[model samples]
Target: MKLETLSVRIGRDVEPMAGDVAPAIHMSTTFERDSDGEFSRGYSYARADNPGRKALEQCIAALEGGHDATAYSSGSAASLAVFSLLRPGDHVVAPIESYHGTAKQLRDIIGPMGVQYTFVDMTRADAVRAALTPATKLVWIETPSNPMLNVSDIEAITALSHERGAIVCCDNTFATPVWQRPLRFGVDLVMHSSTKYFGGHSDVMGGAIVTREGGTLSERLRDYQGTAGNTPAAFDCWLLRRSLTTLVCRVRAQTENAARIAEFLSTHQGIERVFYPGLASHRGHDIARKQMQGGFGAMLSFCVRGGREEAFAVAGKMKYFTRATSLGGVESLVEHRASIEGPHTVTPQNLLRLSVGLEHADDLIADLDQALASRS
Candidate 1:
């Protein structure tokens, strides 16, 4: 089935339990077990497993074209699930420009745990190939990467890692299942902060990790999620299930709105550069065009004519696009990337990342037009 079809069927189908159309939430924290002290389906507690998460996992795994998936409290939890597959001495390669929180987690949390990582220019296949070492166990990447929309060559990176017996994992939050399926390309694992595209409305917070091979890595991560206790709530799963049903529809709408806004920024006087995969001027246009199916993506970044102060002015002026963090919500958001990433980070001082929402494209465009006009 297509992603559109899969999205609708994936958590919404309840197998006619009492002939109810939508699945009901499982609110019980503990389950009744058989006399032998085993669950009917091996589920004994909410932290270990639940019917709602299983439903969501199966649905998302199907959409990502993977064998299985796991859910978490936030995208970070799902991300940690993938990283848990590594050990104290393992090394990993990641793109230089990434979400600030993830970068901090890698440096602050994992580094102290003795897991070493290198940040390279993933756009250049040569740079990725050179970064590979015998101790390298994984390659973490984001295409149309956060804050800066820099697209990575997945095929090259995956091929490079596979040659050395390393697993490749991608954070597909920016490009949801509607636009791209990483498993189709030799990738071993795919992760998402379901709070973004999967939750659509951004009301719920959750994360998911999907893998083509649900072998040792999947088993270990599942065990870690159960033991580590970062599992998502049943209510969040229920809301996320509801969000997935309309995932494709909202993404299509946001994509259209984003394209118009990006084009407007490209020509506007207050804008210096626009980072959108749809734009022909973008460096990764060819790769993204080849890898992705329909629209480019809803997330974009643009630099104002001046630096940080001017960028904040533009963000403050947005009426429809809220000046805040996080994306893939029903509403739009604008944030100055450099300020949030800190002065030591790679983000430019002049840029603002925009998460295009489901608002009318003309209204969004007009607001941006006026916002830039106010920058003068």
Candidate 2:
């Protein structure tokens, strides 16, 4: 089946007893055992496994063409689980311009746990190759990277990492499986903040990790999840599965809106640069074109003509786009990237990241036009 068909049909089946089209939420924390003392139903504890979460994990794993997957309470916990796979002295090579939270987790959390890391410009294959060491256990890729929209060549990076015995994991939140599938490009693992795209709305919080070959890594993640009890609640998992049904439709409309808005920003006198992989002028356009199927992405970032204060003025003037943080929601959002990342951030002072939503393209373009005009 095509992705559109799989999106709606993968995790859903008619309930046996209820005969309901939509699956019911399995909220039970424990399941009954047989008189002979066995869990014949394949689940025994909520923390270890739940019907709702199992459905979601199966859905995402199939979407990404992976062998298996595990759901988490949040994207952070899922991320931590991957890092937890490494012991003290394990090294990681990561993009210099990734989501701030990922970088922070490595620096503040994983670093103290005795792991070593090197931040490199992932767009440059040479830079990534130069950073690898004998100790490197993982290579982290985040293409159409947060705030910068830098695209990494997944096939190239994967080959480089694999040659050196490193596991390649990608943060696929920005470019969901609808746009790109890292496992197909030789990535060992694929991760998502199901809180964003999978939920399709801003209402739920969850994360997931899918494995390409389903070996020790997949088993380790499952073990860590059960032992640590960091998996999402039953209701959240059920909601995520429900939201997956419309993922394709919502992402397509939002990507169209983003392309239009990006083009408008590119030509505006008040804007300095628009960071969108779809635009021919972007540095990573060629690679993104090859890796991303239907569109670049709904998220983009632009720099104002002047400095931070001027950028804030344009954001404050926007009528349709809300001045806020987080992305992959039903409503559009604009945020001053540097401020949100804090004083130690490397993001430019003038950059504003936009999460284009399901609004009509003309309306979003007009709102941006007026907001840019306000700066003049």
Q: What are the clash counts of all predictions, listed in order?
A: 0, 0
Candidate 1, residue 40: how far the Cα is off, in Å: 2.1
Lowest summed lDDT across 10 adjacent residues in model 2 is found at: 367-376
- Local distance difference test, candidate 2: 0.92
The whole-model lDDT of each prediction reads: 0.89, 0.92
Worst 10 residues of 1 by lDDT: 11-20
lDDT of 1 by residue, 31-117 (tens): 888998767766788998988988899999999989989889999888878888888999999889988777787888888899999
Model 2: which residue pairs collide? none
Query: Where in model 1 is the C-alpha error above 4 Å?
Result: 15-17, 374-376
Error of 1 at 355 (Å): 0.4
